[model samples]
Target: MYRSVGLMAWKAVRALAMSMTVVSGVSGCAAVQPASRTAGAALGLDAYYTQSVGWAPCEEGKTGEWFAETLAGVECGQVRAPLDYRNVQPDGSSGAQTVLLAVARRPAAEEKTGTLLAISGGPGQTGLDLIEAAYPPEVLAHFDIVAYDPRGVGRSTPLIQCAGGLDPDLDLNADDTEALEAAERTEVAACVTDTGLDVLRHTGSDEATNDVDLLRAVLGEERINLLAYSYGTQIAAMCALRFPANYRAAILDGVVDIAERPNDMRLGQERGYQATFTRVASFCVGEYRRDGAECPLGTDPAAAEEIFQQLLRDADARPVPVRGGSPVKATDVLDASYTGLLWPSAWKPYLAALQALRHGDGTAVRRLADFQDSEGTNALTAITCTDTAGPDHRSHSQTARRRS
Candidate 1:
């Protein structure tokens, strides 16, 4: 996690600490509560709460080989979720459609305390595959570390893929904000309409929280301790709100209090980026940079942003050439730089990209910009669009893009 004067570094650090603390604590025993009595009772779920999970190796194609080698105990399973959580059968027998939620867990070495459910930041990102490597062995030693693919995410039943998987051609840097807004809205609307509104309509934070509760019942645990990052903090908070008794300790890092809308969160994200960009620019000209490398921006941190702004302007005119991919326009660069500043690990490379960008090669920046996207962008967009309630979030983009 990256931090600056205005941005909070503690959010990212706390998220990591949440992953680490399970081992240092005393072990907790499971109550083996019947699903019908706990999670099922709350949600009116039928057999879903009590369904025994048959833990298997990596769930065939769900996990990559790297995770299997890194975390030896990691196992994959699926929990069923209703398509429409709001409208369910009166008898709780069956009325709504169900989908499989890909789940991953690494059981504790000793007596397990309550399970630590790690919800990743992107609502669309897949945790079942990569979450095992994120924590240390000591962390893995204390409790069952669990992660899952929210409905419509990786390996989940009935994937919601756009016609070309988020349209790699959608550029963020169009001069006209209206054009960009229209393009974005049209693309997402097509995805929702094509994928069926019923499925897209159900991908809300409230519904996702129910899935979390269902997961608790599947594990037969009394309460689940939440460790969440980015947008996941919202989901964890929602769980805490809905099932207060079922939640143990919820650690929200990079906390997103976007109970209103993305714009509300976007305003704060802008502050975080401004602070991080200032820090990154200062570091670029500092002694820590690569040996024998000249500071590209002439050591004046104040003027550094002006230089970068010029780069965005220039790139917007003639989109920078990316290696073996679409040309990156100014909008792409903006999105990329914003994404890079979110994590500290990407800072060095981002700086390198900026340095190279000055010399006319944007491959590095373009690559970092591309890195902002994961396989789950469609899911992220869909869930984000449907989950939060407010005036359209994209209106703010017009204000951002209009700046000269």
Candidate 2:
């Protein structure tokens, strides 16, 4: 199902790319001037839109070490956006609190045709890392590839943090609603205390979309080509809908259906993960048989799923002990498997990790879980919870009931 959706998305991107190529050829590349103060004044965002961005080599510790290594030659800068756009004083005065967003750009290798704004997923992932890891040379040759850390995310000011980070030992299968609720309340309080409620309140997708437009204006581009993945697809769709004129074309990869209810979306994700795991287990058995080796998951697919389930149950009953770290919980195993499934390259290693766990060696699985949970902050939870409206107690109760 995901493969077909990905194929369709690729086709759409190809069609849009062809059209953009023709448009660029006909129009020709020209230096675009920064948006005029008068034009910005009309929209009451003159201060934000007209601010100058001083691009320089990303500093060693300021923009992250990965940025320096992966995005060599890329320039980094910052843009000040209102903490709350709705509460802007219109004069760009001191009345509105601001957030400093980290921005990066790799200049076109050849003549610049236009600007391509890339948005990463996670809502907490840094866009600079996305461009460095995913973008190819052909893309860099045609357009100036740009990316930014959305407010409250990496490199952005007023970052969301929780004391000691989120608990790594959380047992998702546990039916202690009171304990879970207490943990959630404590986490929220820490985030609010550390990052301010105002910042957290405005870090939703809607505000992030506004920040993208502010970036567009700051870049002096009349319209930008967009490439968005996963959770970013929600922001991209909102940008296209709210500010239609500001985008030339958009490609939404691993598209998220924003119209779906949040609870249903989460349920669908779990089902997808289960299906993928079953397929992987089946493949593991076949490959092992071909190689005259025993498969840890056994030959039967259903039985393999049961084996995985028992591992989770065992982990929940008594966490899998690691050599140098805290024991791994059932949630850790699930998280690590989900993260591994995200990349095709990790599938083989993921199977090996599962085999290791079956043999009572959980070091590999623990490492995978650590990598997935490495963000060590509550930015993802803050943004997602803020974006989703209404109380979700019904879903929470349903989940607890099912688990119980």
Candidate 3:
């Protein structure tokens, strides 16, 4: 886990300590409760909850060799879930349709306390990537570290994708709201055309939490623990609220404030990114000074903001050339900077990439911008849009005014 120092960091540490205490001290495990006895019976989703999982060695072709290698002692499985929970049959039969959720688990090395369900961020990101990489050794030794690709993600059925690829070089800096809206509509239409609206409509956190409960029943666990990050915290929080009895403990890191509207969230994120950029600039100058090397952002931290702004202007005037790809525009550099701020380990390389970009080489920054899987973008957009209550019609100016 990335380290932070503040009240929020303390809260996270306290939460983790409390969860570990529960994991280490709990005993006299209760029998696995059938889904029919719980809320699933009322929703007519018993079939999904009772379905048995057939775990097998993951095929490298489907999971990729890197995944198999990273999670050496993992087994992959699938559990059937309703496409729309509202249309389920009373007699354990699929009403509208069913989708298979791809799951991977590494069993506890020693005495198993309970299952720890890890949910990855991005709404579109695969949870299989977190199995071994995210958890500590004690967690791996005490509980079955399990992860699942949320509906319409990764290897899950009815995967969200755009038949016509989204425009990667869309001018994000343009003030034309109509052009931006048109591009957004094009992307959404492409997703709906490829992945039906039925699936897209139900990709919200509510359905995702239901899937988590179904997973718990399939795993024969009375209650599971949750380890979720970033956007995943939404799902974990939903699970905690909707099916409190189904989970024993939850650790939500980088928590998302679910109450905020989409536009409000975006504005908050923009402010946060600006603050992080300033801090990164100061850190860059200090590190360079300590090492007796020239700092690209200059000696004064205040001047770093101007330097970056000028770079953006320069990029807009003449986009930086990438060797074999589309030219790196100002928006691409901005996106890449945000991506690089995600982890401390990447800061040094990000600084180096910025230095390179200042000299007309954008290959590094362009690579950073391309970190997100293009196919996953569809899911990210669809899930985010569907999860929110209503469409946001406000323009950027209106949003800023409301925020102020």
Candidate 4:
């Protein structure tokens, strides 16, 4: 389960920090020249994308299907880059081919502050969508928002491939774990090694940081404002570290400390779960006491936890039918509970889920299961795994199963 690290405390600290900073980072603008197709050296553009993905223009009220679609009043374009950034013209035709997928939006009004580049997370998550959503009328009135998807990601060519099937809806029983693990192992081997070690090697915080500088130059911004989330924070931090001059300020949500990298994600998530369990249990206990009927739990919270454990074990053996679609399994239950950890808003749904599980009603439980499955995209996993230093071909299926 993913968890926020000290949400209450961090919110206070972040609020204070943000208050100390000025609201507007871009101001007092002089007339700027039009952007050039070629990113020149003067703007500190070291790399260029030679390929691009198309952005279907936004209609009156149409939403971009995926994250990278262009927003209203925004122009969408694609930039192509080399599969290998180091050697741009690998084929010797015209250096190597490189594409940078880009989405830029501005207010319908003429006058605007500047462009604020919005970056998304998952390393694989589409940053373009964030720009379109975050840059509503209020923000758009001030600045044009630009976002891009990195290589091997959304709309970016040569997508990373995981050998295993990512059918989130599939129920993974003990009988299925072995097959699932094997498939995952196969998929990982294929996707990670597809570009060989070079691209995979370069696909870290450092390279992404450098890429931002190139983007800044290509977009023709003297300095850019950045709003990033989750893994996007890592990319922004890298950009700041490498090209501190390129940024005015950055707003980071679900921020990740660069130094923490991969280790903190799992450990921090576990701590967050432990805390949520405490909060959720309190809610359950309070509700049980208020109802006073049979009490949700036979005895106290301790007994309730025991009952929950029993439910999980039972679910593992055989799925309890819910929603008329399929039965709810332990894995489904785990995923739903884990999804709740992503945000405080999910607490209510989680509460409902627990009640449903208690009564053997699988519909509510299935909803949670579906939410969990929704997130199990192949791209997210690839990006996460690639960010780490490990054997691209190695499979942890056996280990994962043993742990389970």
Instruction: Please name the candidate that would achieve the greatest lDDT relative to the true structure.
Output: 3
List TM-score per model, in order.
Answer: 0.80, 0.82, 0.85, 0.67
Poorest stretch of ten by lDDT in candidate 4: 395-404
Off by over 4 Å in 4: 1-56, 59-74, 89-93, 100-111, 132-140, 163-184, 192-203, 280-310, 322-326, 370-376, 390-404
lDDT of each: 0.65, 0.69, 0.71, 0.55
lDDT (tens digit, per residue) of candidate 1 on 33-103: 32232553444565677778877766355445424353566687778777766566656676678888888
* lDDT score, candidate 4, position 257: 62
Q: Per-residue lDDT of 9-109 in model 3, one digit per residue for the tens?
A: 33532344335434211222223242222454345766666677788767554555425354567888878888877777777665578888989888989
Candidate 4 global CA lDDT score: 0.55
Superposed Cα deviation of residue 254, candidate 1 (Å)? 1.0
Name the lDDT value of residue 52 in candidate 3: 79
For residues 301-401, write the lDDT of model 2, one tens digit per residue.
77987888888888778887788987777888887887677655577778778778877878888988876343434777777667764546321111110
